[model samples]
Target: MAESDGQERTEQPTEQRLRQAREKGQIPRSKELGTAAVLLSAAAALLMLGDALGEALSMVFEQSFRLERAAIFDPATMMPALAEAIGGLMWPLLGMFAVVLVAALVGNSLLGGFNFSTQAMMPKFSRLSPVNGLKRMFGVQALVELLKSIAKVVFIATIAIWLLWSQFDHILRLSGETLNLAMKDALELLLWMGLALCLALLPIVAIDVPFQVWNHTRQLKMTLQEVKDEYKNTEGKPEVKSRIRRLQQEMANRRMMAEVPTADVVVVNPTHFSVALRYDKDKPGAAPVVVAKGLDEVALKIREVAREYQVPVISSPALARAVYFSTKLDREIPDGLFVAVAQILAYVFQLNAWRKGQGNKPVPLKDDLPIPDEYRV
Candidate 1:
């Protein structure tokens, strides 16, 4: 049994959920996806930057090595080659962008049934509030952001230290060379630095991906009123209690008649209402309760099935209607009819005892209750 609190608890709106998620330092914010795009984009940008520096050093290093003649590197001759190289690389770069875009979309989708809304962007002048700005600066979210920054610095420094140790021999090797050679070497170092940067940024990326999803879910939260509205839409408007009761009774009658087998007796109106009653012999002084009841054609089906099952069919029209109208299935017979029903049950039990050849047991019942002649069988 539920205690009546009279207040129904419903879900909160998406914005509140998002605001809470954000406060908790949950990751994968919307901008993080954009950040992933930037990271991947940086990879391509680094490649180009590395290439330009490499070419400048190539010019100086070629002269120092005395290996070949320097035909001044011309844009006109190299432009086509550059275009060809870019075309070759385009597929992979596009794939990288696509992966980030899809990951962001999926993470966002899972966090909430994420829906895009510009409503969040529809103009706010909250920047004027110095108090809110101060709160944001000192908030839990600000703390998380500060932690992420510290982690990135630590990660990058560790990688750089490792790189220095690994490349110490090369740095010490005396290759009599010019500024071009130094620039080329530095460019090579920067290429590795880009990778280390991406690696260092990975934690922030991981964190933000989840936050983005959480942020999206928060935007779609359901307020109490919205929860009720959606439920009503799904379940349809509530029906009157009386109508619900009637439908329940009708369904019960159909089910009851289907279980006419194994009943001890069925009290009937001969042509109108029929009710099948069953009693467990273990229970004493308790009259059989109605298991199935029907009026009109359904009543006829109950009698037909009762006859087929060879259950005793007692014609007691007044009792049949009284029990059918006054009691519910699986409940005890009502107080008013307890004595009359007990006698009928006793008579039925004696008949069963006689059939089993136990003894000649006399029917143990009294006359029926007085009722209208029209309803009497």
Candidate 2:
């Protein structure tokens, strides 16, 4: 029933959504797996150190019960004896506890790496609501948890019953043995019982791990509109992005138009294209740079700017298109068009001289300017 924009959440969660969930400490974890690991660790530790622990306990009991009149009367002596006995008993058990703790840590880490988020620790008032609490108690997740608990109890009970039933003859024989022999047999029986219980939990843990992972993934499923909205949040909203692009174009156009007034000549494609060129002979190895270029309305604006500054404007559709395409703004024209551009510059200079009454008007501007064949298109 989970939906967004009237569409069900049929799609798998995206990477961004997964990352956010992890940041919020929502990761797949199996409590049953951790419990099984701890139980197994405790059983293994007891098997390995059981004899040492038993001896320590026996020594503590012997010391506590030893009848010494002077020790009983002296509070200091009795206190030291009691403390030593307790410490000796605790040392071996502490080692076993440490092993179980390590196993629990490793089990959890194997499932979800290491996740520490303060957001998960924060209190939520919604959890206190009676209606919400009832919903959670009767939810699918709650039912699954209840079933898992039942299965664990059944498995352990079956294992215990079978182990005890098979060892029934051994249990009866223990009463006829000496005290030391009877205690040894009982310890061995308990060890076997612990191992059987741990073994029974393995199958349950295996199923629970995958079930927890699948359930977590199902909860994070995203709808189509949710995916789109997340994409917009990560990339940017469409309208805002379009506005940014428009602003960038306006800034570039303004910069190009500003350079037109400083150009030596403006090459026009009659209506569609315009490119302004400027050459500085004083600057060594410098070719004419395209100071400005534009199309249509921008081209007309460039021509107006050129005319305001008295820069010459020549209508040469092929040359204008070639220069506009080949040259970048504020960069020199390509070497392939060197001869053709040089001829036009010479013509412009000659025309300028004639207008100053220093030389006769050079041949009138013609349609066939010395344009390179390669640049014609």
Cα TM-score per model: 0.38, 0.63
- lDDT by residue for model 2 (230-332), tens: 9889889889999999999999999888888888899898889989999997899999999999989999999999999999999888889999988999999
lDDT scores in order = 0.67, 0.87
What is candidate 1's local distance difference test score? Answer: 0.67
Lowest summed lDDT window (length 10), candidate 1 = 1-10
Kindly report which residue pairs in candidate 2 clash with one another.
none
Candidate 1 wrongly placed segments (more than 4 Å): 1-33, 44-53, 56-117, 172-175, 178-183, 211-226, 229-377
lDDT of 2 at 367: 77
* Candidate 2 regions with alpha-carbon error over 4 angstroms: 2-5, 68-74, 176-181, 242-377
